[model samples]
Target: MKISARNRLKGKVVDIVKGATTAHVRIDIGNGVIVTSSITNEAVDELGLKIGADAYAVVKASDVMVAVD
Candidate 1:
């Protein structure tokens, strides 16, 4: 798929938690690091996300904020 987002991480679905309207999907990108994304339940189902399923974490944002304490 061609997307405008350049930051794409390929990983496998590790866990999933579904809520009323949203769902938390976790993907392991290797080195024991996992990325979690909160998306709509319809999206989760439409993508057929499940444990051991291969997927990509597409990050598309205009700006990112970082704070150091």
Candidate 2:
């Protein structure tokens, strides 16, 4: 409910791909852009994440990396 991270992009869940331990939660942040977060399968279940549901992609500035190719 309360987080310190400022980079919170609200969007609708587009897809969910689950692996052995981690799952990739894809959220469409609008404008044909999607933000994917790799989280534990348990986290995904606990959060009850499903397609067409609202979710937020929380990003920490310190952990973000920029690459120029």
Candidate 3:
């Protein structure tokens, strides 16, 4: 619980897909890493995001575009 965003990714919430108000949270920020976010759905039941629990996928951006072919 801090202010500044530092692209934190400490996760274990392996999946949660809802709609009609957004909710696509997936986190597994380990060796086989994964990080997905689409909050809302009442902030996923007011941050009681179940499914293995333990989460933090904060990726604030100002300018981050890396595309190659």
Candidate 4:
């Protein structure tokens, strides 16, 4: 899926935690890297986001503020 946001991170789905109305999708970036995002239940089911699946974590923020890590 394409989004207007430029800060998009792509990875393979590693884990999925389902909740009452939300689900957490975990993606493996590489070299033991992992990132998770909270998505809607409908998105989880519609996109078939599951373990060992390819997915893109597109992050859209109202502001693009940054700080030194």
TM-score of 1: 0.87
| Residues 1-69, model 4: lDDT tens digits | 456887677789999988999988899978888988888888999987768888777766764578896
Question: What TM-score would candidate 4 get against the native?
Answer: 0.80
User: Which residue pairs in candidate 1 have backbone atoms (N, alpha carbon, C) closer than 3 angstroms, thus clashing?
Assistant: none
User: Candidate 1 at 3: error in angstroms?
Assistant: 0.3
- TM-score: which is higher, 3 or 4? 4
- Give the alpha carbon lDDT tens digit for every residue of 1-69 in model 1: 698986789999999999999999999999988999999999999988889999998887653456899
Q: List the residue pairs that clash in candidate 4.
A: none
How do all the candidates rank in terms of lDDT, highest first?
2, 1, 3, 4
Winning candidate number (TM-score): 2
C-alpha lDDT of candidate 3 relative to the true structure:
0.86
Q: Number of the top candidate by lDDT?
A: 2
Selected candidate, larger lDDT, 3 vs 4: 3
In order, candidate lDDTs are: 0.90, 0.95, 0.86, 0.82
Candidate 3: list runs displaced more than 4 Å: 1-4, 10-13, 31-56, 59-69
**Preferred candidate (TM-score higher): 1 or 4:** 1
Order the numbered candidates by TM-score, best leading: 2, 1, 4, 3
- Tell me the tens digit of each residue's lDDT in model 2 across 1-69: 798887999999999999999999999999999998999999999999999999999998897889999
TM values, all candidates: 0.87, 0.90, 0.31, 0.80
